[model samples]
Target: MQLQPWIIMATISAFLIQICLTVESPPSADKIDLGVHPLELEHFVNMAHSNQVERSCGKYVIPRVTSRVGFSYSANTSFYAFVNDDMTARDNLKFLQRWFLKFPEYKNRDLFLTGESYAGHYVPQLAQLIVQSKVKFNLKGVAIGNPLLEFNTDFNSRAEYMWSHGLISDITYEAFTVICNYSQVRREIVMGSLSPACSGVISQVSRELGKHIDSYDVTLDVCLPSVVSQSERLNQPRGTEKIDVCVEDETIKYLNRKDVQKALHAHLKGVSRWSICSEVLKYEYRNLEIPTIHVVGAVLKSGIRVLVYSGDQDSVVPLTGTRTLVNGLAKDLGLNTTVPYRNWFQGRQVGGWTQVYGDKLSFATIRGASHEAPFSQPERSLVLFNTFLQGKPLPEATVVL
Candidate 1:
């Protein structure tokens, strides 16, 4: 069978949506919704065609920065939702095959698979499946951020992250690491058989974390559900530098709006509302234990490029653990570091730290960004996105006299 022609697909399987085709341009902030992202689907097409991204910052001032953009966040993608999201990967793949069949134009184009969070699994697995089957389109590469690659490493790293970041007491950290962890607590919750010891440690951790914190990106503020939820009021970007912590709530409100759905040609066929996460779908939690880092190796062995990046500020999937795993993967694959680990620049500032291995595999970190890197640091994230797609290394830091 001949491979299909060109391009990419952005996965949001958690929400049962597959981005079809998306167009973007210079982002202008004329949004009325405060907590919501300034750019929305309603205006993105026009904005993208505008040809100039208004920039803000000191010294490294750029008024109309021109660079390639992607659907770095779902905020800018055109997507098609699976009729039923509560399905297995096999089922989803079959649906996607049919979806691909419908778009004959997609045949023969190089297809790039990408996503965040659990997509570390979804993206790689789907790419592997595409390889196994005779699919149209070339498998380009994969990029995932702050993803859950290994459950033990990813979840267990929280103790150190919490302690180092001053989110938990030393006593709490010791017990949390020595006694229980986010994964263990979760397993207990899932099995409906919480150990007394696990319960106590979990309760302590929860108390320490508090409900007001967005544990995903500890540096970012939490969305006040009372204020952002069920209200259309706009507020200042209170999350981080420009990230509105409550944007999560804002997205929900926007998607559920009847006018918004109508505009997107979307509807809640089997659900009451559009949700970023699926509530009805029963995920096999065991899948988390099966590390995709190995699957990443398999992809590399197949000669496909792999880029595993992290948002350094994410406590949920701390950079420390991801660094260890990525390094180990490089060693296992016998891939030598092509570019030594060092700071990369966006303009004159260190955007993040990156390391490339054997040209085929690379790892990098987005400095001062959140778990959702783009949401927290859009310009920096866009830089990374552009570089990754171009198969170019992040810009090297420049020396100033």
Candidate 2:
């Protein structure tokens, strides 16, 4: 007896479903198609417990578009939104391996890892790890935006930025001097009372200094002022749209889960510290030799790009920092050749610049934007990524915006 087409299709579908069920899913709740242009993006979330989705890079799968590739890592494990830890890095590599196995067509794809802020550290560390695994893996380039690569430079840049941005005042600067001179205990106590007026004075002094400063623990001081203002701003409801891009509610839940934190805590033992800059600077600074890659765009690549983006209005790692980091990476990779600087934004002097390193390295910057330009201006970011994907130099500013 011959079966009907519908019946045959149903039987085949059921059999396939059973086979898939037996094969073990990709350790993800479900894969979602973001429907972005140029690339048909697929996303995955770790919903092991709660119904809410927790974005996990290692869990997401997308067909390799070209030999060129892009990777994103969560910024910091301390915060669920930015799960930047050794475990996450291992998982990312594992996922890439799985992705390669699942799609052999991308065997020759050149990989470019990118991220921002906390990713400054995450991107480079992962790149180093992936390169080490190059005997078994293939990678090409990396980009980091406002990365925190060098402990000294990173902290100093933050201090200089805060001062220049008018976020710190002379009083705050004095407090900073005192803190750096005294014990951490005394510094913390003094910093607790510095007001906005003090912060503004610090900013003016920082500008006058005209160079980056790093001799103090200014992360809290720099960010406290902004955080306070942001909290106030967030107090007002923004209609129905979400204003901030973070997994705050889900993050809290994950943090509260002892098992989850334990899993993360184990991996974060030595690599991550509450204030890595301060701790390392005091003791373990010399132990760091991890192969690192920093991915930066012309603008910010916050959670949207798999990292946290910290911007300083007054910064060396400002637009300059991103440009310098990418350029340095390009040069280090032998990709830095005499490529022309192109203006990509309208009325912007230098929206972007390009240099081709050896054969597989490249670098460029975004136009008219500050540290977090990627978040502020995404279109340009897309343009930069697209160019990098094509293995071509970034275009010079044409329309002059």
Candidate 3:
């Protein structure tokens, strides 16, 4: 089987941007509605095509950021409404097999699997299937950003992260740790019942955190109009420098446009609007508990490199828990530390800290970034992406005299 010479980037819970094949200059900032936040996507692509990237990796590969047909705007919930991680993984495997058969010209070219957030599960599960299947893909590596690897560790860490960041009161933090951790709360919610104690704790925490903050990025401000109308119309600045907090709303509007939908061959099946998340598809919430960290271990054992990265500022799937999980996974796999934990540089500033285990498994954090690190810190994320694809360690901190 011949796979496309493509770097597949998936966003788990965001509006899909149909495949962008060219490397043209990015559009102006004023034009924010390109379905998937053009600034971030274009910025990453432009960086990938830079002369520096060419010098580092010998050549630049045009990346193709796509989502599954049954997801986002392409979903036909009228027929098949229920979906889960396993189903998503199987669907992705089938998609890739068909893609390989259709694009035989991309034979022997390198392919890297990358995603963020819940893709923590989707990417690994699909990779595991690919590795175990009969198909032969030149699978280079897998990278997940602010991924959910383990349920308890990832969700339970939110309390500490919020407390440390001063997003919640001390009393609420204590309640979160003792009376009800996030994992327990999540379980109850999934089961469609929340205990009185957990419900009270949640209310108190919500009151303390207020309505202005974004839990995904504790440091970033929420879009006011988005909160009110559920649309992206505000011109306010966010806590993060240069990131548009209203991009999600813009994407929702763009994807729902009749022209945009027609152009992409997408239609709203048994639905009136296109949402960032599926409104009709009932996802199996229990699947969130099935940890994918072990699947990551299996991928590593299959000779496929794994890169687990986090955005340090993210309370949801914060760097602390991810680091612990990666360290534990390394110890369990008996992989020795090949690269000691150290700061990496993006130009003159520190990009983040990274550590490699036995050359196959690695962990890193994007400093001053959010759960969606690439959306918030595109340049640094690009640097990390390039380094990972080239099978090179992140650049060491540069010295200045």
Badly placed stretches (over 4 Å) of model 1 are 1-87, 225-241, 399-401
1-401 per-residue lDDT for model 1 (tens digits):
11111122222222322232111111211112211112422211121110111121000101110011110111212222221112233443554576458865544454455556666666666566666775664667777777778878888888899899998999999999888877798677767899999989988988998887777688886766574442432432433235555665565666567775665544344357655554433344556677888887888888788888888888888888888889999999888999999989888888999999998888889888877676677777767766776788899867774
Q: What is the lDDT of residue 264 in candidate 3?
A: 50
Please report, in order, the local distance difference test score of every candidate based on alpha carbons: 0.60, 0.37, 0.68
What is the lDDT for 72 in model 2?
18
lDDT of 2 by residue, 286-349 (tens): 2222224443231122111222222323254454444455566555544445555444432334
RMSD to the true structure for each prediction, in A, is 9.9, 14.0, 7.4
| Most accurate candidate by TM-score | 3
The sequence of per-residue lDDT tens digits that candidate 3 reaches over residues 1-401 is 11112333333222321221211101101112221112332211111233332332322222211222211223343333555677666656766666657666453567667667777887788789989895887877887888888999999999999999888988899999999999999999999999999999999999998988888788886875536543233323443247667666566666566775675555444557655544455666788899999999999999998999998999878898999999999999999999999999998899999999998999999988887776677678778877887778898757875
Model 3 / residue 362 / CA error / Å: 0.8
TM per candidate: 0.76, 0.46, 0.81
Write the candidate numbers in order of decreasing lDDT: 3, 1, 2
TM-score of 2: 0.46
